[model samples]
Target: MTSESQTAGTRVLHLSSAQLARVSRALDGDEAAAAEFDSALSSDPVRLLVEVLSTKSVPAGSGVSYGHTFVTQHPTVLARVAIGYGHGLPRKAGNRAWVTWSAAGGPAVRLPIVGRVAMDEFVVDVGRTPVEPGQLMCVFGDSDEGEVPLGDWAAAIGESPVSVIACLDRRVTRSVVE
Candidate 1:
């Protein structure tokens, strides 16, 4: 069995048939499951990019998004993302998920979702970053650029990647990348 840890809390467990069964029992009490693993925690080909529709400044104690699930800690700028649970993103991601925003010609900055994820949109606290509309956000992309991983996204929202992908209906446009 092999496993590799990736950035953004992605871990892939590679196990053969026997090893896999052993792992299952090990989860019960077998200490033999402790071993280095070589798994598929590598960068994935699929990435989800969402656009920034708008941004706004809020004072401290400000409640963000629907239900006020999260409140502003201080004066910060919140940027709205263009996709949400209705678009296949997990609704549970509200205040639990993160996205990567790359400044124009700069490195990617990881931002947290500040409020409840809506039907077609979400919010990110872009603190201190002069973000603007039309900016592309890497909701889950390659780790090389500090983007979130699909696995991490699933874990954050308590779902599997398969389920997440299946939730992406025709309403969400699909683009092929080489």
Candidate 2:
């Protein structure tokens, strides 16, 4: 049984039939099922980090993204990120979700994902933070600034992580950095 892990990086666990049974028992609220199951599952290591492709400062009440679902309440800086539903970011993440970005000498900022998630692009309201075109953004996963946990995103979309994570498009590059 292979699962994502943080801290020590990735590991592949080949659980035997007996071990699988133990994991099943443990999941069923068994108090003393298997120590391996308890020790194995740790912080999720999967992170979808992408580059900001562009940035623009829009005036107050400006309509954003496709269909104008999000109209800015005030003048704000916006960014176009590289990922979209076509890249495995869910369309449901449109106006309901957010991403984080860290500026060189400044603290991390939470930016709302505005408008509809397109096939290959999405917009984010960066608020007052001055964002650049090449800055990296945390679409999801853990970081020093914080995290966009899978559970939070799942809750926002009324779906499970198992259903959503797999939606990440295969065409998107995936790297294993240890």
Candidate 3:
């Protein structure tokens, strides 16, 4: 009935602070509210970077990853991303999900996670991309250059985004960006 009651109802629905801001935008014509919501919703706080620990050139018929879950159908370039279950990368991600990788100054390439993700690393089919030792791979996060969104990982592994992110091991090196 009253403006105060409407605002109070919106706030009572357990909406996030960002969602509340959007509601306030409609109620009070606060232009800044939209900006705040966008910043909060779209910006991921945790970005993961994995180094390429090694690379193997596999001929067709080669088994990849752990347990031979993936067998190369053709000649392929495989690289090991140096973060694994021990680093908070879920074992369930193996052979089911993908990671974003790029050569220096190159466009991002999507690579499949093959085999069982080990405790310390996982295998990716680089597929002729020129990957080298120490090249960076995005494990998960928001990047201006683009990345595998957390939702995609969730869908791949049948987990919720919160669970996917919350399981990250505390030993991970976290760097904050503005």
Tell me, by TM-score, which candidate is best.
Answer: 1
Candidate 3: worst 10 consecutive residues by lDDT? 5-14
Candidate structures ordered by lDDT, highest first:
1, 3, 2
- Candidate 1 regions with alpha-carbon error over 4 angstroms: 1-43
lDDT of 2 by residue, 77-160 (tens): 888887777656689888898777777766666778999987777899988777888778777655444757545655676765
Q: For residues 32-63, what per-residue lDDT tens digits would candidate 1 score against the true structure? A: 44221112324333467767878899999999
Residue range 1-178, candidate 3, lDDT tens digits: 5332112110001224444445357346565654454445345323467778778898999987667988999999889777678656689998899888877677777788899998777899988888888778876555466677656666789875544544565555434334
Task: List clashing residue pairs in candidate 2.
Answer: 1-15
State the C-alpha lDDT per candidate.
0.67, 0.65, 0.66
Clashes of each: 4, 1, 0
State TM-scores per candidate. 0.74, 0.72, 0.72
- RMSD after CA superposition, every candidate: 11.1, 9.4, 14.2
**Better candidate by lDDT, 2 or 3:** 3
Identify the candidate with maximal lDDT: 1
With a 3 Å backbone cut-off (N, CA, C), the pairs that clash in candidate 3 are none
